[model samples]
Target: MALFVQPWPIFLSINYLGLQACFLRVFMKIKLNNVCIFPLAQILNCVVYCIFVAMAAGLPFLNPYKSTDDADFRHGVNFAVAGSTALPTEILASENILSPVTNSSLSVQLGWMSTHFNSTCKTRGGWCVNQIKYLSFFLKQSTYCVEKLKNSLFMVGEIGGNDYNYALLPGKSIEEVKKIVPNVVEAIKNAVRRVIHYGAVRVIVPGNFPIGCFPIYLTRFQTNDTAVYDEDQCLKELNDFSKYHNDNLRRAIKDLKNEFPNVVIVLFTIILIFCFVMLYTGFDVMSLQKACCGIGGNYNFSLTRMCGAGLPVCSNPNQHISWDGVHLTQEAYKFMTGWLIRNMLHKLQCSV
Candidate 1:
């Protein structure tokens, strides 16, 4: 907990300095074609520029576009890894999906990435190397990314919930979990700042959605006592934590708005986002937190038991609430994304 406290201005300064160094060298060489007295100095600068950029940015992820099945605004991207609350990048990557970066959950993975340019981290030795082929792929496109940082197509970040769950791992109490709320909020702020540092302006920072309702939490934390599950389908305590995170997030966004007057940071809460869906298209909101598709027992949904391997899926997955225990079905994502597109465009006042 103390590790993260007051990391912002310092880390942000280090990050900015790194970016500035890269920008100056790269731009200076581009401008001074053959004018320089020493060509060797330019080459040395180029090598240093790349090393820092790679250190600051873990290899870039493939940019995912909006699902093509829907016809509008197909260029959006989602950085939010499922089952991650700014879930440590390492944990998400452990599942073989995400590459652990600054806000990652996997400590080992984060350490590996930090080892690249930092001398302190280098003593750890051989930490940040991924497959050679992956490294080469990123190197080829690294320069182009800096140029494209402005005018980000779309930004999505949902981070820091897993940290609270981690707090629960070592004999923590409700009071302890409550204490983590502030830190989680700050983590989200840091993550948003990092993305902005990389050049995302029109961003959507989603709130924690119903972690208490997760089937794994319910089954693992269950007591013989009947007071655990609430009628709307989640442990009240977990949902309360979710509510607190979202509330503080709203405040953070307000503060950010004060800080950056021109950018758009929409505080898209799940329910408010859901309400826009219900009103415009009239999607039924039954069991909004319950699994519509999962392999777990009646109410709990999870990947442990996949909903349908080869068998038939729900006839109307859109209408059903839970998709898998941990995620909503593709159909559900469609409606939600559609609603989001409308609201975001409305806020930006731009037509797709």
Candidate 2:
């Protein structure tokens, strides 16, 4: 991600110099395969008036109700696509649950292809680009997105977990991997800052799900020590580690809010809401750690026999939360999205 606001001299020069600087930056950034930065100068020019007003008024003086009226707020959704969690899966998309923006009368002008985190990635056949490398690629693709950034609600991630997943996969002890948490948080913070700089007014930054409850973690870290397991049969240690990550992420977002007080950054704890949804529907929590689709194993997952086309799927995916060891089932995502919109629509200044 690009640092658009740091180091005053370069920032000012880029803006005053004009479009040549902007084009040059875009070309070089694309060449490096880091298509996340905008011409700081160009973006600066676009928001210069707002900045002046905000400064004069003592920071973040933009009113949410200023442009919004009864006819409604028009905004589209965009994912920072790290993998299947944000991707529109066939099961959900077919039911139209995945196309929230499309269903609401806003077209999905840009579609995200599935990509996995480099840490735990098993396959890479689809348009799955690395998030760390291509942060702003989708937003800059068209003028339509650029113009709508001010009103659009951006979902920054279900990210950062893959980084830890990557770390712990190679026989590294949890303690060793815990050190990587701050670095991961920093990367997320940078990405969030970049999106805000691009003119996104509202962003929901979700932290990692409780990995202790994940079948993949249980299968990989199984032990005879009963003390390590929780009442839900999930690993307590790993879940605590996940909490640590979420805490740090939340802190970073708090810091970002201090810097950009006008922007709305909601820290969504998906696991907390996830557990509540599971209990509310009276689903078997034991089945929570079991993959809905897979071949054979203690947790229905194996390095060799994972979820695939030929694998046996659960009688009803709606009854289970996890699809594979990592991703959630469509039913779960549907509920999560519903809960999110009902609760956050007001903050996004969105109605539909």
1-352 per-residue lDDT for model 1 (tens digits): 1111000101111111112211222221221121213232211211221112222222122221112343221111222222334445544345333332235242322232133123221212233535354555455455344333333332333456555555553346657567656765776676555545544454456666666765556654656666876765457786777787789889998888787666667765775554444345544555454455454445545435545544234455566444554554444444554445445556643333
- lDDT score of residue 29 within candidate 2: 20
Q: Supply candidate 1's per-residue lDDT for 139.
A: 54
TM-score of each: 0.54, 0.61
Provide the overall lDDT of each model, using Cα atoms, as 2-decimal numbers: 0.43, 0.50
lDDT of 2 by residue, 1-352 (tens): 0011110000100000011111111111211121212233211111221122122212221221112334111211122222222222332344232322222110111111111012112222235546435534433443443444454444555555655665565466778767767766776676666556655566667778889988788888989999999887889988898899899988999999999999988777777887776678656566777888775667887757777657777786667777776677655665665566446546645433
- In candidate 2, the residue pairs with backbone N, CA or C atoms under 3 Å apart (3 or more residues apart, or in different chains) clash, namely 114-128, 115-128
Q: Candidate 2: misplaced stretches above 4 Å? A: 1-147
